[model samples]
Target chain A: MSLIPSHERPDGDPLRPIQRFCEVVTYCATLGIYAYGVDGPKVCLALPYCEDILGDADRQWINTGAITTLIDSACGSAILHALPQYEAIATLDLRVDYLRPAPAGGEMRCWAWCHRITSNVAFAQSEVYVEGIDEPVATSSASFMRLKPQKREAG
Target chain B: MIEPGHLKAEAALPPPEQFCRRIPHLQHLGMRYLPACVENHSAPVFILGFQDRLVGNTHLPALHGGAVASFMENSALLHLLMEQNGTSRLPKLIDFNIDYLRSAGPRDSFACCEVAKLGSRVVLVHIRCWQRHFDRPAALARAHYLWEPVSGNTELAEDIRP
Candidate 1:
């Protein structure tokens, strides 16, 4: 399991549904993409390369899908940082540009910034970087729609 | 997942079934290629089965956007590979853009990809994903893949030459 705790827990909210949603979201957790600290208008995350994500048995490279998942989640997380109370949001569109396929076996990180927040929509952009690498491995931008609050799932 | 490193050094081109099996993530996610429609159109069809692991919103019970997006991108790569089997090397993704038209219901999903443009060094593909109806798309995506053409020439290359 990921060690990073929910940023909303200490606030007694314990459930930033947005963050929790992404955590359980299939691609992110499977590949070890974790939520990092949040700055003023930006949210960050870490992506770790694991054996399971390797594209093939012989190649020491990860799949494009894994890279896309990291970008998509990073962009979506910034939407949570943009909201006043961290409400739920759904992705409306996501665009990712991969500069190159990073070699497998190193940890990569992403930082997402929300530049615009309207009454109903939020926009975010993010970049993926590998440690010890000069250029970014990939970049992405996405839009999310704020969702109405919902009651917690019944225990 | 087809090991990116092992793709070089050519041998007999594995059939589509074996090709998809090589990519662990695609198989784990239940992605499959059907050849029924390839005769009509140059592209093949891909289908992903619905399961608990793919759910995003447990309440609305919709398929996860990441899952759908990954599926589409993988299909784009698969279709491009199928069109010409000259190279065993996997294509590098240049970029992918996806638009969610509607919530994808939790069901088996079907999709197809068309090669919009194919250059010696770059290939562009458009994909449409749907569940219940062909006209109603749950999501659509455009993807670009970068790789040296099989023949290694832009126009001189015979479609796919090794």
Candidate 2:
């Protein structure tokens, strides 16, 4: 059975707000990453391959850096989705394991989920899959520091 | 695939700058090689000039975590390539772990790497990235790379000399 909520499925526009958030992040925007939608507790993102993002031109392989960007963005978005209310967050640490080379000319998709959220930190994990490939190309684990809400003062 | 005729020892190897330049993503990110004085450090240094497209948080106006990671990874690759005297194929990245020490502001970011262990099949590199003071680093990374052995290459047997 599908774990995603019916309303939050990709067919609906539930991800419009998250998509807008991704648009403002210049690095994410530059990479042409898009928020696909929310699946259950996970957030989905996609990166379409382009010639400029190639690391090994001879092999037509995508750069590891580009793959890192995709995972980071997806993990951050997952944290946002898991939170009850909007809160500022920053990456504390990230670890990526490259299982195999992701060849260029295919869209790389990622699904990230925030499994734990404490008062100070949030932990997320992501798996990156390439089009036509069944196994994950890469996997990542990341932690985000949740900034304390700033107290407003009367003018 | 490497051609047999293209294999040579030291003189025929392409410069690190040329190897770095051939990467489209590095060029896209505007990363450049900076020659390092032999006395200060052994490995070459790299600089990534701050650009609007590299920013992750416009509110804090900080460099993206991934951008910083990319710079450090590139730095490590350059270091390994220099140590091996260049290889026909690029080293495959096995894994990378990074810690964000501080937020990198809008400025040119610099990176340098230290090889922790040099093995016949794999090598480990530790990378540091900073915007201002070298002591105050913005990020630290450890990456492991699988070295693909090329036939008739004697340099791979010596391990990293430096």
Candidate 3:
């Protein structure tokens, strides 16, 4: 993965919550872990390379485990980024399908759309791609729980 | 202290050879297979409580994500190995999902899984990786398997005993 995104940010800018989230995701992705990201409209996240996520005994490409984590993290990050906006969506369920094996040594870009935001729940779908491509590597759909953030009683 | 139900035994372990047959990939990883409780129904589930090999970095390096995924996949595949108690066979994975709660510390872990549904064409499996200290879990997974049943093998209802 490239550090281009990090370098683009001007120095001494106090990090935003969303930016922090991106760093967490990037940290994991760079080390071959799965974590959340900054891009929305299609919420972005990264799935890093690791020997354990490979299926072929040969360890040539990513496997089902990596794909599974990417979809889950993408959906999770999307909900988190939009949490202040949609107060009621709980994650009811999520499903993902891998079109083919994603190559190792690169990060996955997950772009998700909030298809529907309802009174008590939100629905969304996402596509995962590598190195900015039109054909998706994987796709997913998710449902989130909706509830008002907890309030503290007056002392 | 470990919970009474969680502690593992030494005997009755399912050999890793069972996985090598089909995936042939796991064998190359050189992971040791420790036995789960015998009551788990000849399940292929095994545990590799924390070992130094799993640590990735110093100063509280979270358990490697790749390691976490490996444990999850191994737990799911154990169901196929369990099917052959006395023989050897490899089962094909149909589908699987995982919900990660937190990053694992550099400690031992317990891996367990089972076949929830078995049919002529497909089987469903649920797998989990529980940390030694944590109360909730490091991660949880569910997987589906496509079975190529051995001829002359009898079909039976899946036991939820484990």
Find the candidate with the highest DockQ and give its number.
2
Candidate 1 residue pairs in backbone clash: A55-B1, A55-B2, A56-B2, A56-B3, A59-B5, B1-B23, B1-B24, B2-B23
DockQ of 1: 0.48
Q: Could you tell me the TM-score of candidate 1?
A: 0.80
- Tens-place lDDT per residue, model 1, A60-132, is 6667777777777777777776666656688899999888777777887787888887777789998888777
True contacts kept of 3: 0.10
> Which residue pairs in candidate 2 have backbone atoms (N, alpha carbon, C) closer than 3 angstroms, thus clashing?
none
Every model's DockQ: 0.48, 0.70, 0.12
Instruction: Report lDDT per candidate.
Output: 0.71, 0.80, 0.55
Superior candidate under TM-score, 2 versus 3: 2
Please tell me which predicted candidate would have the highest TM-score against the true structure: 2
Going through the candidates in the order shown, the clash numbers are 8, 0, 20
TM-score of chain B of 2: 0.80
Model 1: residues >4 Å from true position, as ranges?
A: A1-19, A56-59, A147-155, B1-18, B37-42, B86-88, B150-162
For candidate 3, give the lDDT of residue B16.
Answer: 55
Query: Model 1 Cα displacement at B144 (Å)?
Result: 1.3
Q: What lDDT does model 1 reach?
A: 0.71
Ranking by DockQ: 2, 1, 3
Winner of 1 and 3 under lDDT: 1
